[model samples]
Target: MEPNPDREPGIPTDLLGVARIAGQSLRHIVGAVTKGAVHTATDLVDDIRSGEPISQIFDERVDLFRRAALSALGLTSTETGVPVETKVDAEDLKAMGDAMITEGWDSAQQPRELHPSFVPILHDLTPDEARILRFLAVAGPQPAIDIRTKAPFGIGSQRLADGINMIAAMAGCALPDRDHHYLGNLSRLGLVRFSTEPVADFRRYAFLEAQPPAQAAYRSVKMRAISSYRSIYLTVFGKQFCDACFVLGDYTGGGWAGDDRGDIYLGKGPRLP
Candidate 1:
């Protein structure tokens, strides 16, 4: 799959998950090949020597290698996007053999990149889940209605609630039953917090401690309060979202006033008592 350039830098963590699946498949294929050749090894050798079953050997070996390769790559039986046909031609096999003779396969080495091709931060979350997180991170604490309004896809309140439930399920957390339950779960996870009062008829929520700090004091504070939270946020929004929200206030217009090009002042300058 092609990588999403819009995603944050760094390889996705989901790719590793796929690689692990692939590795397991490869091991199974190797076992199958060994088992298939065990009883007929002598007969196959005789046939090969006599040049009688040359095509049979080629076909069988090619099929075995192809299956093994597909399994190793974690490819499904049916191709979804990319063409996954097996390159089992004799010429290709001979070329691979020749390369192996010169370069040698590193048996000890394992695939390091298992991350998904999409945004690393969102490897675990679906599109809806990620959108929910992003919305929550930006809009602060909010009721389901308000949250839905701010979501990128304009998801309805019910759909947003469903996505939130899905996210909780994916994180191995409890599913929330009501609005308060959702807020409670998110608060417990430290991903969001509620305001003392509601906003615009909706409860306000904020993304608290979205990113762990680098310093010891910050780390200690976060560990005490935010450790239970999943690192999945790091993969979806990346560092920029947290940095802009916490430090720069860029997402909320940095408190700038559109009318006067200054901070929006709420207090009266001089009140006559």
Candidate 2:
């Protein structure tokens, strides 16, 4: 198996830990670029011209940072990737404002806090629930119909609407009677916030914070699985090999056959019949 670099020595092994680092790094980069404290080519020229830090430069923009991260991870077009926007549509912007307004009043003015433990709310979810959570994580406060249709898992369009409802029920979230009921539940959990309206059935959900506990649990599970799988393969082969070795054969041209040879070689190179 590929030695999960994420779990490598000194790396932030957990997904949430990585995210926290990324967020902090991005924020720092933004601050630096904005304050003209970093001497990157783009920032230096802009700073010299403006006689101050350039507030509107690309490096200082969160959107740019998000895009860059997405691109680096090769998830820019996947369900997890953020949508590219040429311009903000007016109706969509208005809907976002309305959703925020509604959310602001409904929560008794308490801003929801996302903790890492909330990751179980997503990780322990069924495929359907995972689908909904993934959609919400990427798109943010969307209508059920929109969430269903836009889910990355290829759940059929006809089933999208009902799937979201089922996920909500499974999550034990109390659905509101209003149109935004599902969203309200998500909001209470601090998973997402409504941000935009449908220019063409377009509702936007903004990711707020990942629950720390949930993320921790997910990382734990992932690590266990990785370790377990590695152990199993090692037991079978009597040696550890990378993901590439298992799939494409080892550098020594030994895989399952090589495994047999390894056993013989380790035990006794050859035998006379």
Candidate 3:
């Protein structure tokens, strides 16, 4: 089955609460890819037939394809008024199609909305960065120092119980270095920030703070002064980005604390036990 050009994918309201691009724009991308690669184009069309929402198939990276299509349409960026040069190669087209499939693009609905400030960031984000954003969106506004805990155990042991450490380990980067690298990139992109003030709602995160083992661990150690720590949080832009893009709903119970490492970590969900 093919996607109906007249309808938009049915995205969850909570997920759609953030901004998104118009369904027309996505259709334009699909049309453009169809002009080139039939296989890649069919990947998106197949999802549309399966009744998947376009939101599932797109991320911030969609901005790139949108810009390219706009350029083809002879549209210019409102900010610069310069014609966007959308010269895509075969590789890029394939990648865009793959991203749509990966994002679960469905053809159940035809949407016509477009986010006003949907500009691609300076650099492409890594899976590690996406992981960090998802974590912050769930169990963030945490101390930077707590993430610095380098508890060494066997490779299979629980190496990353702390949220910050989990992000670092997943990215294959280490502390301070991870902060300076991935975190730094996220900061520049306005997706994340390092600050002393708590951005996450205290009431929303009370359960995590109230966990018995976590409290016992804090009680067992003489932690540094609160003033000495900085917390990492998703900025408003980051939150919107996550909503419009990544499949954050797949995250369960802040599953980042699980014993799984590498690729299996995010799949394990939050470690409530």
Candidate 4:
């Protein structure tokens, strides 16, 4: 993790009770990386012959483990190791743990398919942003206009802070106060993409017809037509994230995974038909 600007070197002021917790919190992280692989038997025998304490070796590896965990969690760290004053928030730690379980281990203590790529995806997202991804995982691609129109939370009034808080109260999870901003964040993550016209690249995905009443309301407020309607679709990276990190139940068969989008970058999208 990056050094906390407010804390002194070697200080233990993080939300997870300081550096000691790294031993426990990062065990799975190390295990996933090593995947129970071991060095040659001759090398192990040589180490024993040299009288190097295996326990000491493990302790040294634990430091490496901690640094790896922090990196996977998208926290900044030096090539050598975690900074002495690095700090991580509780929410970020929780998200990291969730990612570890989803990508590393399963309930039966069996090794599941590991997706190291998903770690950064989970680490970089806020809880609200992650919730939006999970929603899209099952909900599939939705029209930007419908998100602001027909859905219950889509109503313009719900964009207010208080309205968003109220929705959170019932749903038990916070949502973005402004839908456009939320979608923008997702776009920044390269998980979701948007288009104003029915582009051929995403033509197979659903299109949203702007409601006349909603268009009228936007006109009354002098909202630009271009901003008033859009088609939102998940990129290939987004679908892979949802598959690795979420449960999609029976929804499959080119629904979320339409076609190869290659590697999506910030502000860049696939060519349209």
Could you say which candidate leads in lDDT? 3
Per-model TM-score on C-alpha atoms: 0.22, 0.17, 0.35, 0.40
Q: How does model 3 score by TM-score?
A: 0.35
What local distance difference test score does each model get? Answer: 0.33, 0.30, 0.47, 0.46
The positional error of residue 45 in candidate 1, measured at the CA in angstroms, is 28
**Full-model lDDT, candidate 4:** 0.46
Worst 10 residues of 3 by lDDT: 11-20
The per-residue C-alpha lDDT of model 3 at residue 235 equals 86
Residue range 95-157, candidate 2, lDDT tens digits: 434433443353433324432234334433344333334333222222321222222344433
Summed backbone clashes in each candidate are: 19, 24, 14, 2
Candidate number with greatest TM-score: 4
State the displacement of the C-alpha of residue 89, model 4, in Å, after optimal TM-score superposition.
Answer: 30
What is the per-residue lDDT of model 4 for residues 71-121, given as tens digits with 9 covering 90 to 100?
444444444434433465666566556655554443543334544446655
The predicted structure with the larger lDDT, 1 or 3, is 3
Comparing 3 with 4 on lDDT, the higher-scoring candidate is 3
The per-residue C-alpha lDDT of model 1 at residue 180 equals: 41
- Per-residue lDDT value at 82 in model 4: 45
Alpha-carbon shift of residue 176 in model 3 (angstroms):
9.6
Off by over 4 Å in 4: 1-55, 58-114, 145-173, 199-217, 221-229, 250-273
